[model samples]
Target chain A: MTNRWGLPHLGYGVGLRTVHYAEILSRWPAVDFFEAITENFLDTGGRPLHILDRVAERYPVVLHGVSLSIGSTDPLDLDYLAKVNRLARRVKARWVTDHLCWTGVAGKNVHDLLPLPYTEGVLAHVARRLRTVMDFLERPVFLENPSTYLQFTQSTMTEPEFLSELCERAGTGLLLDVNNVYVSAVNHGFDPVSYIDALPRGRVVQYHLAGHTDKGTHVLDTHSTRPRDEVWDLYAHAVERLGEAATLYEWDEDIPDFATVHAEALKARGLAAGIHREEVAVA
Target chain B: MPEPLTLDLVERWMQTVLVHPESAEAGIQSSPARALIDPGRVSEVVLASGHLTVAERLGIYQEMYLLRMRDALESDYPNLARHLGPHRFWHFVSDYVEAHPSRSYTLNRLGDHVPAFAATWGKRKERGLISDLSRLELALTRVFDAPEDPPVSPEALARLTPEASTELRLSPVAAFALERVRSASLRLLDSPEREVVPREAVPGSRHVHVLFVRKGGQVSRRTLEGAEGHLLEALTSGIPLGRALTRLGRRHRTTRPCEVESWFREWVEEGVFSAASLDPDP
Candidate 1:
């Protein structure tokens, strides 16, 4: 399931975090690709960006942003967009991605990925904005389904439906976060497998596997530890369906050594291997 | 027909609820959120899950807002947080965000106003010291994110002829900042082992000039006084070298012109200048 741009699958990777900088530079681990939080690197011209330049020189890198606020009603932040675009080009990111959520409006940033209502009106608004963003960026934008805790009654469709429809209308790509799918499904009392199946096949260009704190009743996507067993199970299912795409493991809080996070990211290889075996069986 | 829940209204309601300094209930009832959707109809706007009501779910976002802001600010001002202790630091952060919520996309800029805000943070005994520390940390943060321009080479400094001093233009290194801070706060922050202690335990609120520079990929500070600080400020202010030296000479009759040349050599060796050009245009 190649994307419209035919971006290659860079295989299993881990987010390039600051905690792991010294180890990454010293050991130069054999991770396939490194996903950087674009906003963290954008405004800094210091050590973090310095490390990113060195890391980009060695391996494939992709830019995942949080502050794009794609669904917000306020006028688009052209300065932020220009910075993101310039950074993607500066780092030679394979493709740029942000969340399918709004961060804030009214010229103020809440800095959290707030949920969006899934309706025809909102869909058309977001799709038009996404197209404008992609045109300015001069590349197809990829959006990930964020882990949402609340749903709007005004929402007319499920998140998966909204995502598929938006991707189709906007002519963008998808970075399906399996963990978020599971988190949102569990919170919303929907079937995660069904949600995955509903996604547009060729539109998904990447995958994010991360840990979440399941607070018995509601799940929080904290990205603080290794992905749970259920999340890994979901990743296996995702690889089976999505076939080939770049996969990244995220551990933003209480992050351990590079070896620890890298080891967790390496677990995706088993899932990718399972896909190959299933392909052989189908043949 | 009642106005449909347009994207604008939905965003306004959610942002209002999420950014309220108090509970989400207060946010939903605020005039802005209420204007978008009736306070009684919050459930109709934001659907509730089995375990949590709409307000409680909104509480989740409301709760995380300050925590995220604190985390970013803590990264920028760890020494300040350490000095203030955990509980006081959290209080300070809560008050700080309310006064100046993030207007920029990057969290790096969220603490841009902390130094000034700390200065006005309640009339406390340690207010001046805390403000000084915060100002120092803010300078470090700015220097860290400042544009990365390589320092002028020693060879460039060596090539400067005394006759060319009148036309010489020196541009401060991109990752360089000047701060006037209390000597006591400077010592405490510079110490490797930092801890919260009584305000009186540290001495010297007397003013001191400090030069912050990013060299070898680390932000470091140097103490400066008198002509050193003045000459550097002059160079940074676009005053040519000869005129700057003349000003320093006029101000300090006891200071030798030889000292100014030494300071220039020292600044160049310290990688304080990004570019040095002879300015006929200026």
Candidate 2:
């Protein structure tokens, strides 16, 4: 289960949310790894960092950021990158990752993972910025596909093609969020299986499975409930193609309990095992 | 047709529409969106699916913009949001973000200007109290995020002789002193649920200064008054023990020297000072 860069497969885990903070510290659940939101830890030196220090001591914690804004038109924020790199070093994070969307423009941060037009120009622009970020951090970063509500008429390439080319050009890794693939496919009229099949399998280092809001016409990446049956089917498809990767379940809003989330994450194990058994039978 | 839309132009136009205060269609016709791309040409740039049109698709982003902003502000200022209620809080969030959109990489800093902005809520009858509550919460936030410096031990203070104590220079941890606040407003924070308490029309009318310190990863507050307040402020501000005491005595005639010594002992025990050094002779 080695990625192109030989990053380790950390197995199934859940997002380290704040609601389960106290429970995690006291009980210390039996999870393989924890994915922390990077922006939540960068500015504060107090309780958040304090708790993170303790968590990093016991578990493998990876930093996933929202405000990296790698696809943004604004100049790269070197100071922000420096802090991110420092935090990575402090926690000894496995790898850093962010979405493949622009957050905001003209120096203001709207804080939403806004979509990018899939064009040749966009691919080159984002690749250039991503190279700078990876070089500055001295590590390869994973970029996740965003669930989009609309498509730009200016886009000449499909979402998967654009992401594949961008990863190749930038020398980065793919997070391969299957739920995002399902959401985007449903919203924009594309085959989710085709989206999974097109990605560079070796470049995929991680997987994100989350529930979304079905708004009849479009789907929102709310991360508010359990992963849908369609999303789980896509995750199985991803495992068959990509072999093995670190899978994480995310439930940000209306989070029931840590145990419940952990149980949901454990479901990935059965899918991964099924893929492994098929590979053995073929061998 | 006009020249083909570049990636930059598309992004600019989309951002303009997304951040506009009005609906997505109205946003397209607005000056900012029009400056980048014409409203009539929006359909040319975006593809439409079944029931959803181009403008409606773009509207999804416009609607989400405020929800994200309010979520960030509400997390940082829960009590203040409760005080204003959801409706007024949403209005405040809109105006506040428009006035001071996030400039930092982290949403943690999104509400940095909330306290000062709250002071200008003059139209509300409880504006002063709101301002006071905002300031207190802001302090807690700042203290929570501020750098961690180990506080000096009580043994360090005990080792100093009378002569050394007079010339002792001290450094306080981050958030050493917050503004002077009323006893009533300060007590409001003591409630199990601050929102349930009745809003005060006028807060900080009974002036009592507060001290903020980072203790074991928690931000703790203490009330100080008269000489006690002045003395702590002076020490945290880098005044030598003798000079700070002298200034306090001059300003507060009722402050006794014995009381000052006991206050110094209490501050030292509470881990107020991070470092202490003998002041150089003049």
TM-score to true structure, per model: 0.94, 0.94
Give me the runs in candidate 2 sitting further than 4 Å from their true place: B1-4, B122-125, B175-177, B187-204, B279-282
lDDT of 1 by residue, B1-282 (tens): 556777888888888888787889999888877778888777678898999988999998998998899899998898899888898898899899888989899888899899889888866777888898988888877887787888999887778787886778889888898877788878657533222222222346677777888876776677777668877888898988788878888887788868876887788777889988897665
Model 2's alpha-carbon lDDT is 0.84
lDDT of 2 by residue, A1-283 (tens): 5667777899998898878989999999999999999989998787788889989999999999998898888898999999999999999999999999998888888888999888888899999999999999999998999989999887899988998899889888888888999998988989999888988777788899999998887989899999999999989988888668899999998999999999988999888888889999999
* Residue-wise C-alpha lDDT for candidate 2, range B172-230, written one tens digit per residue: 87645556666666644543322222223334468767777776765557777777987
In model 1, where do residues sit more than 4 Å from their true spots?
A: B1-3, B190-203
What does candidate 2 score on TM?
0.94
Q: What's the residue-level lDDT of B176 in candidate 1? A: 90
List iRMS for all predictions: 1.0, 1.2
Give the per-residue lDDT digits (tens) of candidate 1, residues A166-282: 988998778999899988998999999989888777777998989899888799999997888888888887777766688899998898888888888777887788788889999
Residue B143, candidate 1: how far off, in angstroms? 1.4
Q: Candidate 2: deviation at residue A183, Å?
A: 1.0
Model 2, C-alpha of A134: deviation from truth (Å): 1.0
